[model samples]
Every structure is written in structure tokens, then in C-alpha cells.
Target: MRPVGCHNEVMTTEIAIIGAGIAGLSAASELAEHRGTGEGILVVEAERDAAIHTSSRSAQQLIPSYGPEPVLELTRWSIARLLEAGNYLAAPLAWPSSFVVAGSPEDVAAMTVPGLRTLEGAELFELCPELRVNPQRFRTAAVDESAVRTDGTALVAWHRERALAAGVEIRTNSRVTGARRAGDLWELTLGAAPPKTVRAATVVNAAGAWADEVGALFGAAPQGLRPLRRTAALVTLAEPMPPEHPMVDDAAEDWYYRPDAAGAMISLGEAEPSEPCDAQPHEGAVAGLIAMIERETSLRITGVVKAWTGLRTERPSDVPVCGWDPVAPGMFWLAGQGGYGFQTSSALARAAAELVLRGEVGDWLSPATRDALAPDGSPDQSATPR
Candidate 1:
């Protein structure tokens, strides 16, 4: 590739990925794996480091049975890679953690999750003693012992290291201010000291919450990407919590919590729609979650150790939007992953890279799945709950 811009300043590459989150890093890794010795791949990020937003702020868990069918399939496909990725991390990337989804009988009956078994009486209490609510309040409970606690920070670092080892150049604090198509390549103007520019044959918009904004900067139409605010709090309990405690999720109430390093992390499971920004946890939401935790569990949250929030960008259908945009040539859509991004990053990245480099879906993903996750596919509005 050759540089093409004014001011005698143009950096060229074969592929340019916007956003250094897990999605972008993983895609860069896959692309680097298949690239020629001199084929350049560049990953640009607005933040100073990777996964500073939704990617690192997630309540990381590898629950294959979670999300819509398409998401579930991707999660299932990603588990092996997540497990195998532990080799790249200094410490284990994932730890075995049981998962329990408890709700009323009607709520449990409506949930269709694979390998989920009903737990009652002793089995339920034994599995998750934290649930002190009257058993009658939650008539049904489903348990999945195969779940794992994914280390988000470690996973991002692993992929970043892999991409670096594969000769992928990652430039942080290089925000893309303007983008335009120059012949068969994209000319991206960066907000740097000297106003740098990057020219690439293909551009992958893995900008997470800002996906639509990046797309519009490059003359692509919005794909209905909606960023929702999700709040989570780390509460310090009066007593020590068992490290082996399974993650407990009240499906009917739309909240889930699990043991953290010192205390526990609780989420309100609220997906309130908002514009893309530096998301902050609402005090009311955090308080509400704390109250709910107290009402549902025996553990009393004495104090909040820490609290944070992040955006979970979702399309209208709630399914991830991947693959190339039908109308935007040389531009790929790798956004709207929501909470499932970390768990499904490996599989989604591989499939996306295949689509970008080979113009077809990889064998690892089914043709049906390929079509379902394609950016231009008709929205399956009923597939996943917000």
C-alpha cells in the first residue's frame, strides 16, 4: 500500500481497525495470522489503552446458554478459544464457576436454555446459599454447572499481545476525526499533534458505542446502533463470601450478581437507551440494585467499595451486527455486541476477518449463522430480550 494525502503526511496500511477493544484486537489478531509478511495491519484507538470502556467494564462470564440463539451459538463457539487463550495470559483467563438462573415458575418455563436443569429444595440451596428469599417466591430455579468466570482484563491483554506478536501496529490516543473514501481506500484524519492520516484498503468499525458515529464520519448510514447504559456496583459484605459461590441471576427481576475479589458485583440489568458517551452509573440504579440484593439474598451490603458503569451498544434487534455493510463498500460492521462481546469475541472476530479478507464466511461458522449476524440482514426483533 502507498500513502495518498496532502501535507506530505499519509500512513498507509492494508487494513485499518478503529477501536482497540476486544473486538478490534481479536480481529487484528486473526487478520495478522493470515496476512503476508509485509501486509500491514493497523489498529487505532481513541483511548490510551485497550478495553477502557465496555470491554473491560463487563461482568465477564462465559455462559454459553445466555443471550439469543445466534449469540448463544457464538458464545458456544467461543468457549474453546477462550479456554485456549489462557496460554497467552500471565494468569488463567477463566475460572470454573457455576451459574443459577432462578425465577418464578412461569418465568422459568418461558426460558429456553440449553443444558439447563431445574434445581429444587436442597439442591438449589446447596448450590447457592446466598438466595435467602422465601423459596416459594421463586418457584423454579435452573442451574448450569459448566459456566466459567471470564477475566476480561486478562483476555484483552492476551489478544493485544497476540496481535503485537503477529506484527499488528496498535496506535492509541489516535482518534479518527474525519474519514473519507479516496479511490479504493479510506483516508482517515487523526486528531493527533500533527493531524496524522491513515490510508487503508479496508476499514473495520469496531468502535463499540461509537460505531454509528464512526460510520457517519465515513459517509455510511446509521445502522440503528443504540447504546444502553448499564450500572454495576461492588459491595463490601459484612461477612466473607465463598469463592465457590455460583453466580445467581434472577431472570424475572432482570438482575444478576456474582462474587468478586473482595465482595460481590451486582447489576441492575437495566438497558436504558442513551446516546454514546462516557457512561456513568446512576446513583438511583445502584441504590435500587443494592436494595434488591438485600431483599433477595442473606448478605447485607454494608458499604459500596466501588461502582462503575459502561455502555452496551445494541441494534434494534439486540443481535450483534457483524460482516460488511450492504451499502458501505470496504467497510465492515463489528459493533452492537452488547454484554456478550467479551464471551463471543473470538468466534465473531474470526468470522468477521474471514468475511473481510476472503469475501465469504468461514467454515467455523454456519452459513445460517453468517446470514443471521450479517449487518444487512432483517432484524430478528423477537430473538433476544433487551
Candidate 2:
């Protein structure tokens, strides 16, 4: 077992994961668990630590009905797994009421899912007192009571520790600058002072926003992954919202806000296309969200104490890209998760481990789901979005 910060002068492994975010760490942990030895596995991160990007910047809510059909399947499965107290995550999952408010009944109907139900008047106002002032603005609303509030920080730490305990070597600050397929193996050049090289039998591209870039180094065709910047802010309210208040998705999903310890966390919810980099909050986007919160709810914004942003990478299908690359034999695609990364991590990781170790996915996932997640750019055959 190699400690997280330790790295050998000369390195070679059977499998190498190209990102230390939740997707990479979780997949590493699962692969280590089933393989029974992590000595052959290595996790490489460009950053000094793991989960310093989108993994830590997510809103951290697990809503099964909040994504495309393929993503919904994974999210539902992940939620079910996480709910089995103390089974998946070390800390307990928080059950929080999640509300989706719309300006019309048609919009509300458009978002209907398996566990969502209509809410109005007193019941709705009781759950979100701030919405009482602008009830007319929100003509209809639906609630998913099973929504779980996850701890992204805890999730990252847990997966990192688990992978390390299983003897997986995690090398931070080791960026793959060059990748060449050599017969049955891949020769990866790390961007170091001396340009260290490592050879691996398999490579997993889980580089979040930079997945396509990493794939190109190995001659793998681009997956058309678009990195979108999402901005959010923490506002100090004139009066603190009740802790029991449900997280609200208002303005036809253009903006949303959830209760935070300081006051509230509001997001613009706009997916602005951007290049891969450390994203900073757009002042105009944060201002736009704050203004909307004032107009749509009773919560008064006194000051915005904090503002931050993250990049959510999406493929053409808007569903996560998994499975082995059709062109690159030993290369696997595990990126393009977008905003549903945290909610869908566990299910995706399990399926990825199965695919990598067994060369095929079992029946744990539906045939349609497996096809939708394939890396060949095939059309998704999953159920139509509700």
C-alpha cells in the first residue's frame, strides 16, 4: 500500500485513473475492493489534493428526478444504495424535502417524476415561508420528499481514505502531459521537471472538465465534452430562513436556493460554456441570482458573503460518458457527468469497476442504461424524460 503523498521514482501499474475527483477515487475504491489488491492500480491528480474542483463545488443534493432519463436511473439507484444507513457512506445521509416550483401547471407537469407530488397554499407556504410573498409568481410546485442532502467533502474524504486503505497509490500533482498507446500498454508522460513516465495496461479518463483533452493524448476521438461554468453565492439574509425550509428550484429551474448555515446558497443555474480551467464566480451571474431571489421570495438579501463557481462537463447527450472507448482499446471514458456527478457517483463507479475488471457490465444496470452510458456516441435508448 502506497500512502497518498508518496510516489515511487519509477512507476508502472495495471490500471491508472486520470483524475482524483470523486469519480476517479470512487471507481478506484470499488476496483480495489473487488480486485482484492490495489498494488496494480494508481490514481493520478494534477492538483495538490483530490476533489478540489467540481467534486467539492456541487450543491450536494441527491434528487433522483433532477436529470435526464439515463442520469435519473443512476441517481435513483445511487439514492437507494446510500439510504441503506451506513452501507455506502460513512456519515448518515440527510433526508431533505426538495421543491420544484414553476410558473405554470404545464411546466410542473413537464417535470413530474415517480416520487413527486403537487403542493400548494398552506402546505407549500409552510415548507417554504419565503415563497408566501410571491405565490402568484409560482403557479404550481412539486415536491420530492426523499431528496437526500449529501456531504461532498465527506464523500471525497471517505473515498480517498478507502482507496488508500485498499493499497491504491494516489499521486497528486502528477499531470499526464503525454500519452502513447504502445501495443497492449499505454506510456504516460507526467508533466514534471524531469518528465517522469509510467506504463499501464489500462487508463481511465475521469478528468472531469479536461476529459476530452486527456483522451486526445491517447489518440482517442473527442467525446464532444463541453465544460459549462455554473456560478453560486452565499447571501446574508435580513432574517434567517428556517432550517426546515426546503431547497427551492424556482423561476422555471433558471435559479435555485437552499438553506445554508449563514443564510442561503443561491445559484444562477445557467450553464455558460467555457474552457477547462479553475472557474471563478461571474459577478453578473451572482447578482442576477440575488435579484431573482428578492423578487421571487420573501427572503431579503443584506449581503453576499461568498461566491464561487465550478465547471460541469457535459457530452452531446447530456448524460455521463462511461464504458470503454470504441477506438482506444485500453482507454475507458468516465467523464461528462455534469451536475449529477455526486448523486450518481456510487452507481457509476460500481458499473465502471465491473466493466474494467470483467470486460463487460453485468445485469445490475438495465440494458438501455448501459447503452446510454457507452462511449461510442450511440443514441440513448432509455425512457423519454418525464
Candidate 3:
């Protein structure tokens, strides 16, 4: 899960994107494809690299039928599009071997979120041979065909390269100073040389953790966008694990871990309410990861190679705030992807594009996109779903 080369030269486009996370990068690629021009989308990011924040530091996994119902639906639609999005994935998107073990009876019971199954103690051992299933302590195990281990950084670079090919200019290190409605166009003052002014008919705010602060400059309300901190660490493996080691996670999602080339990456998987900004990995969270790993497996983690935290922007209802806003008509709200950005990128960008161009609102949206982005469905399609 690594990139091959460097970025392209600085250029401008018709649509100016605010950030370059998966959401922003995906939007750029879509806008570039839709525009079908050499240069019609310019993405302005504050970070020096494309995905220096949450997009890079994520414990990449595609867990469909997980999270909430609406999010799962989004994940379903996203994975479908991701399959055919032409180079949006790292390698080919493959469903890797995964395991979700339940220790306490309470933990086993938590697995049933409708359409989910709990396995026997013997089956848990069969699913993952290395894992120890204490029938006395741990009750059951859950396995499914939907859990897909992913490489998020590779996915980001994939979209980035595609966007570049489509002439979607991504100017990193160029922070947006201000954005306001000047007549019918958006006047974006960037922090570049002589303060370059970008004028576009539409603007997408995808500033990741800094989404709220950026939206406010353009008269877009905070809309309850909270950038929470999630801490993750990469520990050196004591022994090389098997090829098919399932990722061990919980229902409440207290902690999770996956095997990587370097080692295993463990996540505290916390969503702490914090101020909107670049978040750092908490010290206590690191300790908590070690403890969680110990509880899950007997493997003792003595050396930690590296650790970092990223801010996942969330909205009031936990679902992303996609599409246009009530306050800003032409201005689009593409923020609040939370931790599911990479997995949900394909659907989110498709939703945004359909809303922006054709004013088409599909059933796949979270209802928020329908309310603000498109009132009328596409003229060709039926009003109600078949």
C-alpha cells in the first residue's frame, strides 16, 4: 500500500475544491470527468500532501452490513461503484480473510444487528486457526463474506492519479483565505503567490477536520460538524502471521486490529468529542491499544514502531452532510465523512455529482442530500423507486 510517484504542476480548473481527502479527491475526479475538459477542477488543500490527515492514518477496512443501516447501504452502493471506478482502488479490491471474535456472552449477543449471525466456539477456532476461543469466557464468533480489508492510502493515490489525468488540478500548500459570493460566482482567495483569486460557479467544502472553519467564511453554518480524534498504532509483529488472519473487532467498536507488512495496526477506535483541528494521538489511547491487543490475543507488544492520530469529521446525525446547503445554494457541503470516507468515497462522490449536475437524487442518499441538494428526481427516472 504505497504510491509510485510525485504530484503534477500547479494549475487551475473550473471547479475549485477546498481539501484533498478522499472526499475532496473523489469529488475532483468526478468533477473532472463530468466537465470532460483538460482543466475544469482545481482542488486547494492546506496540507503539503494529498492525504496527510485522516485519509492516510486510517485502519483501512471495508465492513459492509456494519455501522448503521443507512451507512451500510452507502457502503454497499460504494463498493459497487468502487469495483468499476476505473483505478480508484489500490490493487484490485479484494475481500481479505477477516475474523470478529466474541469473548463475553454480552459481546456475542451484541453481534445480532439483524441479518448478522453468531458462530459456535468450535467454528471460531476453525475460522481463524491461530485464535484461541475460550468457550467458558468467550461465547461465540461471527464471520461474514462482506468484510473486506482495504488499503486507503493506495485508494487515495489512485483517485489522485485519475484526477490528474483528467486535468483536475490539486494545489497543495495553498490554504483558502476566504470564500464569498461575488455576484453569481464564488470568489476564493487562496494563500498563494500574490493571493490567487479563484472564481467558480460552484464550490465544494471538503476540508476534512477543518471543514467547519472553512465553511463559516462562505456563510455556511457549522451544521454540527465535529472533527473527532481516532488513535492508531503500528506494532512490530513478534512472528509473521498467516496469510489469512481475520481482523478482530467488536460490536461497539471499542478496538480493532489488522495485520500489515510492517506489523499489525491496532486502533482504539474512539470518537472523542474535540475541537475542529488536526488531532494528535493520545498517550492514554496508545496504552489502551496495547491493553486491548493483550485482551484479544496473548501476544505481547513490546516495541512500537510508530503511532499517529487523525481527525474524522462527523455531523450531528453521524451520517455525512452531503450535497448543497440551505444557506448556500451553489456552495456544496462535502464534509463530515467521519472514518468511513475511503470505503464510502464512490457513493458520496456519485451522490454529489448527480445532485450538482443533473439535480438527480437517488434512494442511496442519507435524506440530507435530497433535502438540500435536489428536490426533484431525474426527469427520465420515475419519481418513486421500482
Candidate with top lDDT is: 2
Whole-model lDDT per candidate: 0.81, 0.83, 0.70
Superior candidate under lDDT, 2 versus 3: 2
Q: What is the C-alpha RMSD of each candidate to the true structure, in Å?
A: 4.9, 5.0, 6.7
Please state the error at residue 13 of candidate 3 in Å. Answer: 4.8
Q: How do the residues 1-386 of candidate 1 rate in per-residue lDDT, one tens digit apiece?
A: 44454353689998899999989998988888766431498999998887898887898888877888788789877887777766765777777887788878678656548558888877787777776456876666987776788878877887787788878899999999998888988899999866899999888999999999998887675788989988888888888778888888886876888888868888888888988888998758788888888887777888888888899998777788887665556778899898889878888988887777777775777766776786743253122111
Give the better candidate number (1 or 3) by TM-score. Answer: 1
Q: Give the residue spans of candidate 3 off by over 4 A.
A: 1-13, 85-90, 99-101, 129-137, 362-386
Candidate 2 lDDT tens digits, 1-386: 65665553557899999999989999999899889977799999999989999988888888877888989889988877667744555566545556555556676777566557877778777777777787777766888776778778887777788899989999999999998877788999999755678899999999999999999998886899999999988888999877667778864676888888889888888799999999998657777788777887888999988889999999888889887876666888899999999989989999899888886677878888888898754343122110
Q: Locate the minimum summed-lDDT window of 10 residues in model 3.
A: 375-384
Q: Write the per-residue lDDT of candidate 3 for residues 1-386, one digit (tens) a residue.
A: 32444322233345678898888998877766766752867888887888887888887777775655656767777776766653554467545555474556577556545555666667776665444623455456666556676668767887788799987778888899887777877888887655667788778888888887887888865667787888888887677555467787654455777677777778887888888667787757788779767765655676688899888877766667666655665677787778778767877787777766665666766564344322122222213221
Order of the predicted models by lDDT, top scorer first? 2, 1, 3
lDDT of 2 at 256: 85
- Report clashes for each candidate as comma-separated counts: 0, 0, 4
Candidate 2 vs. true structure, TM-score: 0.92
TM-scores of all predicted structures: 0.92, 0.92, 0.86
